[model samples]
Target: MISKQYRLDELAKQVQGEPVGQSDLKLKRLASLENASSDDIAFVNADKFLDLARSSKAGALIVTEQLRAQLQDVHQNFIVVANPYLAFAILTHTFERKHEQRGIESSAYIHPSAMISDSAYIGHFVCIGENCVVGDDTVILSHTKVDDGVEIGKQCFIDSHVTLTGECTLADRVRIHANTVIGGEGFGFAPYQGKWNRIAQLGSVRIGNDVRIGSNCSVDRGALDDTVIEDGVIIDNLVQIAHNVKVGANTAMAAKCGVAGSTVIGKNCVFAGAVGVVGHINIADNVTVTGMSMVTKSISEAGSYSSGTPMLETAQWKRAAIRFKQLADVPLTQFAKKLDHIQAQIESLESTFKLRK
Candidate 1:
C-alpha cells in the first residue's frame, strides 16, 4: 500500500481549495465517497452527493463552497474549492502512477550511426535504427523500435512497445503511450491486371508539441504529404488516424474514433467515441461530434454535429426503422385526390350561393 501524505495547506494552494481541516494532516490517496476510509480523501462535485460525503469514511473531503455550506454539520474534515473534480484530479495525480525510469539496459540495440543525446534514457531491448536523432531527456521504454531517420524531440516519453516508423518527426514534450504505432504506411492501392498493386507511401508524420497519444492507437503515414497533428492534441486509446490527415491545434478525440484519409479536422474540435469520419472531408474549428456519429460530408460551420439511431428498445427500434424505410414510397397521388375532392365541394357550395343570388 502506498502511504504518501501531503500537507493540507500545500494541497489547498495547489488546488485552490480552502481548508477547514488540520493544515498539517497528511493525505495519502483519494477514493470515492463510498469506498474511502478514514485515511483516504474524497471529493464532491455537487450537493447531490452530499449524503455520500456525510457517510464517507474518508479523513477529509474536498467540496465546492456551495456544497460545503450544506455539509457544515458533517464531522468529517473538509476542503472547500471552486471545482471539486479538478481539485480531485490534481490530488489524484499525487498518488497516480509515476513514470518509471528504465535506464539504458545492456540488451538494447543502438545503431552505430544513431545520434542519441546523452541526456536521453533508452530502456531494455529497445532498438534505435540508423541516423535517428533522439533529443534530450527523452525516454524510450522497453521493446520499442525507432526506425531509421526518425527525429524525436526533447522531454518526450515513448512508452513500451511503441513503434515509430521511418522519417517521423515528433516535437518536444510528446507522450506516446504503450503499443501505439506512428508513421506506418498508408493504405493506398491501384488495380493492375485484376490484381491490387501497392502504392509506396512516401510521406512521413509530423507531430507538434504537447501531443498526448493514448495506448494502442495507430496513426498512418501519408501517401504524398505528411500527416500533421498540431500542438496540444489529446487522442484517446485505440483511435485510427489515416493518411494525410491534418488535425488542428488543441483538438481531442475519444477512444475508438477513426478518421479516414485526407480529412482535415479544425482546431479545438472534440470527437466522441466511435465517431467515423469519411475520407476527404473538412471539419470546421470548434466542432463537437457526438458519439457513434458517421460524418460523410464537409462541415463549414463551427457547431455540434450528430447522426445515428438513438438508443431504443429492440422491438420499438425495429418498428420505427421499418416505417422509416417505407416513408419514401408513400403515395403522393392519394393526397392530391383528397385535395381535389375538397376543392370540388367548395365549388358546389359556391354554385348554390350564386343560384340564391
Candidate 2:
C-alpha cells in the first residue's frame, strides 16, 4: 500500500464537513461502513444507513451535518461534511496503493522502425509495431499491442491486454483500462450473392486529451471517416462505439452502453448503464439518458430522457406483461356503445321531467 496518511482536519475542510471527536487523527485507508475496522475510515451519505454507522466498528466516520448529531454518543470519531460520498472520493487518492516500478521485461518486442520516447515505460510481453510513436512519460503495461501507424500521446497509461490497431491516435493524458481494444474494425457487412461480404475499415480513431476509457470496451475504427472522441470524455466498461461515431467533449457514459454507427453525441451528455442509441441518430448537447433506455430516434431536445419497464415482482411483471399483450384486442367501439346507453338513459329522465312540467 501507499501508506500515505492525512489529518482528519485537513480532509474535513476539503469536504466541508464538521469534525467530531479527534480531528488530528490520521487515516490510512478507506472502507465501507460494514467492513471498516478500527484502522480504516468510512463515510455515510444516506440517512437510511445511519443505523449501520451506530454499530460500525470503524475508528472514524465521515458524515454530513445532519447525521453528526445522531452519532454524537456513538463513541467513534466522525467527520461531518457537506457531501460525504464526494469527500470519500476526494480522500481515496491518499489511501490508494502505489504501484511498484519495474523495468521493461526482456520478452517485450519493439519494431526497429517504431519510435518510442526514452521516458516511456514498456512492460512485459508488450509489442510495438512498425512506425508507431509512443510519447514521453507514457506507460504501456504487460501484453499490450500498439499496431503500426499508431500514435500515443504523452503521459498516457495503456493497461494490460489492450490493442491499439493501426492508424489510431490518442492525445495527451489518455488513460485506457485493461482489455480495451481501440481502432478495431467496425461492424460492417454487405450482402452479395446471399452471403455477407466484409467491408474494410480504412479509417481510424482519434481521441482527444484527458479521455479515460474503461476496461473491456471496444471502440471501432471508422469505415470512411474518423471515429472521434473529444477531450475529457469518460467511458465505462463494456461499452461499444460503432463506426464513424463522434462523441463530444466531457460526455460520460456508464457501463454496457452502445452507440450505433454514425451517431453523433454532443458535449457534456450523460448516458446511464445499458443505454442503446440507434444508428445515424443525433443527440443534442447536455442530454441525459437514464439507465436501460432504448434510443431508436434522434434526441433534438437537450434534456433527460428515459424509457423502459421498471423492476417489479416476477408475478406482477408477468401479469402486467400479459395484460399489455391483450390490450390490442380490447374494442373501443364497445366502450363507445356503453357511453351511448348511459347518455340515452339521462335524456329519457330529462324528457319525463319536462312532461311533468
Candidate 3:
C-alpha cells in the first residue's frame, strides 16, 4: 500500500488535468465518491451520480470541465479534465499493490538445455522442459509447466497451475490467470468402420502481445495450423477457443463464451457473456453480440446483433410457446385474400366520393 501523500497540484500535472481552487490540499489515496474522506480523492464520471459527488467529503475531486461549474459553489478542491474516468484510471496505479518475487525456488526443475533470464522469477514446483526460453523480468508462479520448445516473452505474469504446452509461443506482457491451459489437444476425430479414430494434433497456439486470458479458460491447439489470438485480445473466465480459430486484434469476449472450430472473428468485435458462435463462419469487424445470444451465421457488416427473447412469467411463456409452434399451421393464402379485399373497399370509397363532388 502507498502511504506517501501528494498535493493536488502534483497530481493534476501527472494526469494533465487543470487544478481548481486550493492546489495545496494533500490527498493520501483514491476512493469512491460515496466512501471518500477529507484525505482522499474521488471522481464523478456520470450525471446520475452528481448528488453523490456533491455530498462527498473528499478534499480533492476529479471531474469533467463541463461539471466543474456545478462544484464551483461547493468550495471544494478539484481537478478538471476532459475525461474524468480516464484520469481516475491513471491515478489507480499510484495506489496499486506490487507483489515482488525474485530468484528461482530450490524445488523448481529446469532442464539442462532450457534458458532462463537472470532477472526472471521461477516459483516452487515449476517444470521447465528442454529448449524452453523464459524472457527477462517474467514471473512464473508455482506449479506451472513450460513444455519443450515453448517461448515466453518479457514482463509476462503467468499465474499458478498454468500449462503452456509444447512449441507454443506467447509474446510480451501477456497475462495468464490461474489454471489456464494453452495448447491443449483440439477436438478432432475421424470416422471408421463402427468406431471413432483419433487424429493427432499437430499445431500449437500463438498469442500476440498484451493479451490477458482469465482463469480456467482453455485455448486448444490446432489440428493442422496454429490457433492465433492477435494483439490486445481480452478473454474472460471459463471461455473456450477451439481448433484453428483466428481472433483478430483488440477483440473482447466475456465470461462463458465459446467459439467453435475454424471461426474467424474480425477486429474490435465484442462478445457479451455466454454468447455462443457456431463453427466455420467469418464475422465482420466492429460487431457486437448481446449476452446469451447464439450466432449461427456470418455477419457481413459492422453492427450489433442479438438473439433470444426477453424473459416472461413461466405461465405466460408456456402459452406463448404453444402459439409459437401453432404459427406453422396458419394459411398463407388467407393473408393474400385479406389484402385484396381491403384494396377493393378503398377503391369503391374513392369512386363514391368523386361522384358526390
Provide C-alpha RMSD values for all models, in order: 3.8, 4.1, 2.7
Pitting candidate 2 against candidate 3, the one with the higher lDDT is 3
Candidate 1 at 316: error in angstroms?
Answer: 1.6
Q: How do the residues 1-357 of candidate 2 rate in per-residue lDDT, one tens digit apiece? A: 256777777777777777678888887779898998877789888989989998988878988777887887884588877788888898786666634454456889999999988878899999999999999888899999999999999989999999999489999999999999999999999999999999999999999999999999999999999999999999999999999999999999999999999999999999999999999989999999999999999989899999988999999999998997786577889878999999999999999999999
Cα lDDT of model 3 by residue, 121-149, tens digit? 99999999999999999999999999999
Stronger candidate by TM-score (1 vs 2): 1
Best by TM-score: 3
Candidate 2 residues lying further than 4 Å off, grouped into runs, are 1-4, 9-23, 75-80, 100-103, 192-195, 312-357
Query: Model 3: how far is 174 from its true place, Å?
Result: 1.1
Candidate 1 C-alpha lDDT tens digits along 1-357: 557677777778888778886778887778899999877788889878888888888888888777877887875468888889999888876878765553578999999999988888999899999999999889998999999999999999999999999499999999999999999999889999999999999999999999999999999999999999999999999999999999999999999999999999999999999999999989999999999999999999999999988999999999999987786577988868999999999999999999999
> TM-scores across all candidates?
0.88, 0.81, 0.90
Decide which is better by lDDT, 1 or 3.
3
Global CA lDDT computed for model 3: 0.93
Cα miss at 239, model 3 (Å)?
0.5
Candidate 1 segments whose C-alpha is farther than 4 A from its true place: 100-102, 328-357
